[model samples]
Target: MAETEPNPLLRYLVSDPDAFAHNLAKAFEQAGKAAAAYLKPRETGDTDFGSTDEITRITKTLAHVGEWWLADPARTIEAQKRLVGGWMDLMSSTLKRLSGEPFEPTIRPDPKDKRFQDSEWNDNAFFDFVKQFYLLTSRWAGDMVEEAGDLDSHTRAKADFYVRQILAALSPSNFLMTNPELLRETLTSSGENLVRGMKMFAEDIAAGGGDLKIRQSDYSKFRIGENLAMTPGKVIWQNDVCQIIQYAPTTETVRRRPLLIVPPWINKFYILDLNPEKSFIRWAVSQGLTVFVISWVNPDQRQAEKSFEHYMKEGILTAVEVVEKSTGERGVDTIGYCVGGTLLGVTLAWCAATGDDRIKSATLFTTQVDFTHAGELKVFVDEEQISSLENQMSLRGFLEGRSMSTAFNLLRSNDLIWPYFINNYLKGKEPFPFDLLYWNSDSTRMPAANHSYYLRNCYLENNLTRGRLELGGVKLDLGKVTVPIYNLAAREDHIAPALSVFEGSRYFGGPVQYVLAGSGHIAGVINPVGKPKYQYWTGGPPQGSFTDWLAAASETPGSWWPHWHAWLTDLAPEMVPARQPGGGVLEPIEDAPGSYVRAKA
Candidate 1:
């Protein structure tokens, strides 16, 4: 056989003199077609710019830009003045430092910011200079961004925020060459760290699309039933969507009304049962409350067709039935976290509408039923993003856990994303096996139908609060729910803002004890009474706004768990002798942290 050349396109390009000219003509022809297609609708007086919010935002941005253009002379003068003052201050500080005089940075790092814990910044003058200069540059850029009146709009502000984040992430200070400590380590290790970092990068690229944040060995340090979710309990009931874990009683007698906890399906239920020390389940059991938690299954294409109604029926309603049957009681106190709380609210509304009295009282943890002021998370749950996500899920039938995690991480990129990037890639070191980080890295997939319905009905359309959202054939109305409510909002929660969480109180007709916790979402909820790290505030229900409520609220110096437990105990029935796990229609299927939670997506 005769030898034949490969890559016909390459041969055609090189062999034919006219090929280049022909390709250029073809490219221009395609460009023209695309342009005509895009402009044809506009030419015919037809156009859909975007949603009302998007159009308003774009209009405001343009107006602000025009205003800035008109005020350019004054703004330019002000900016120059500020820049010169900043540089002069820097020069003075440098001279004082050279003379061995005491000097401090004007803008010190926030105590919460853990990015600069290394001692080198203080020990070395050169490193101090670089750090100070970087701060000055960042401040100048931030001032410029603020001065740009376009950022007045929330959408534009968020866009500018992320752009700054990308720029900060690409800063030289994060790399080995600019960082003094990394440079020293490279010198001492003879570039071994660099080799190891390269290897780690390659592995991450191959395995996780460069999203690896934990050491493979660290994952082995924890397991579903062994180290994590080790609270003494049994899987009393289970169905296709979720497993109900009934914790073994720790007291001689327990409260008459059993407690049912509905945790977010986005995370494993083990967050409530991480270990004996921090496990909310263990603590609740100790408090003489019969605790039952719903552990959702990590779904695959097999369950992608499952709707939010499916979750309400199979996840919460089924668990309520089993709990009531086992305890021989008609009513149970319900507690929900994040989306779990949102689901719990919907269930309560449904129960009230149908004259079902299974839920006696309700407690919501960092939950938002009203999406009006939903904080930073609202940036991701728009029409364009949801449509794109739907397309991806249509192929796989579920949203991949890792991909979803990336969006959540970006909400607090400096705290969560960059630190991991530096530790795993720049430092070439193994990540310390922190239990919370492990759980965060272990994510669960969202079923295509359920997730799409949730984003559209609850988030996009804001129907749940508007009395338009229906589930399991019941028209949910939060106003119909008359049970006493205990609502907790975390002050620093980026996912569900405290104001958004508090807004749900307006929909309920009953007495509500709204408490503001001190920390972020997960940390605020997981705060144990014994170790009480964050302070909480007790307040009357929503007054005028979150700010007004905060002004009137009284600060309490410890965890909100004690207050909640007390309120729960006061409402619950008289103490009765403890009962064994699994009875009635429900039988013990497995240990507490069942196979469902352990199943990988």
Candidate 2:
């Protein structure tokens, strides 16, 4: 018999004992630093790393599922048998493959699931078995939650979300020995990858001030006013809550009515003006519209007492006044994105109630006034969870920006969290500079009062569309706002589900042209006309269920910006000479993208 070749992994491990030992020691040292950083005392306002509230909540949710399943002996037996049967079939397939026979996998991951994308996961029998095993167990766990008939809708949703999170955390792809690519890298590099990765891990912990501030992009490469929010404009006015940015018109002539944009304070407004190429602000200005955006302040303890009413009064209401003053336009066309859109709706209602008709036409992007169909975000808005969050906020005077950032990341863990985790901590690579990811990492804090009111009134009670919401001693009635409305909902928005937005269109007492854009919340709204990568759908009035409306809607391939522009022009057809930023009554306070946006959380 021919002598068997030595295993490359073992050969490499022992080939240079001294070098390998040195690298191993260095890796251990870096890992110790990382451990030390993680165990260090947290700063003031920092969240407790070992907080048991969430763990207890998850445990109770899982227990509810277990109780339902175990209540009946038949159900328990059926669950066990199904799981065992899957494992048995998987084992049989592995055995056949080992015996030099071709065999099909017992189960496969969802095609969209990128976690098992490595070719070796299928070609190698061991990894193949591991992938199938995890898929089978995860699918079984999901089925168990779905089949639990007694769990309430909220509990069931919580259980499903938590279980998926737990499964994602335990994926074999996350570990070195289990992940084929990681194992290959370890052997080929003699564990040098781990040394570099551990060093980065420790540095990141320190950067986060005892929290894991995973770097999504090379943040150093991007700056707010220079590379990121470089739109030519002037900060004409500002109050405590926000600064209003009036963009200089690119066109020789502009619309009679200026446009005021209300972006969500959850993030910076530069998402609209990421760069000249992708900027909605630039595009709108070039389309002969005077554009003004409210750049919300990155609030701290000083703004902690600011409430939802304060945001409406000092933020949107003040911006409207400034835009009218600057452009000398009595009425303005207003656009709102996400939570900002929700606030816009409330403002419209309040304006109507107070007989203030400054807003002529209203456009909402991926905004949810009706939270009945609000997606997974509702999972984090229960009374218990909100109370816990409030307690944390009370101690800090504001919710830590990372806390919200982590929740948003968890919503799409595989895409957002895990990819970076693997690349940064496993492959030991720095992420490429991406403007969107950089903007994503630039988070903003939520003032305690403002955040609490938003949670309880919007997500928790669904009061905005129900005519139950009150602000500034005025009962807000969406039905009273009779402005021509353009409601745009993204087809795949997790933050504000299309169905939720669709349901909201009916609450407004006005003609609503409901359009559904392809892609998610960010991509759908930020789609520039020049690129036209996605499509938008249009139909008659938003009537009946979102599904029926979608079926009858006509699909147009390209950006929704032009379509929106056409609608906007039709509403206010008169043209006037272009208005320069701060060219009117309101003098320039500062440059565009404002100092408020520059103040980091």
lDDT of every model, 2 decimals: 0.78, 0.90
The list of candidate 2 runs beyond 4 A from truth reads 1-17, 43-47
Q: Which one is best on TM-score?
A: 2
TM-score of each: 0.82, 0.97
* RMSD, every candidate, angstroms: 12.9, 2.1
User: For residues 1-601, what per-residue lDDT tens digits would candidate 1 score against the true structure?
Assistant: 9988664223112233354345435444544544455455456654322246545544554455446635779877777777777777877887888899998664555567566667766556666677767677677766665667644455555555554675568654588766776766555555555555655655564345323433433566888799999887789887779989888888999999999999999888888888888888899999999999999989998888998889988999999999987889888999999999998988888889999888999999999999988877676676777887798789878988876676688787777777766776666787777898788878899999999998998888999889898876778888998999999999999888888988878999788889999999999999988888899988776768888889889999878888999999899659999977875556788887888989875
lDDT for model 1: 0.78
The 10-residue segment of model 2 with minimum total lDDT is 8-17
TM-score, cand. 2 vs. native: 0.97
- Model 2's C-alpha root-mean-square deviation from the true structure amounts to 2.1
Clashes within 3 Å, all models in order: 0, 0
Which model scores highest in lDDT?
A: 2
The 10-residue segment of model 1 with minimum total lDDT is 8-17
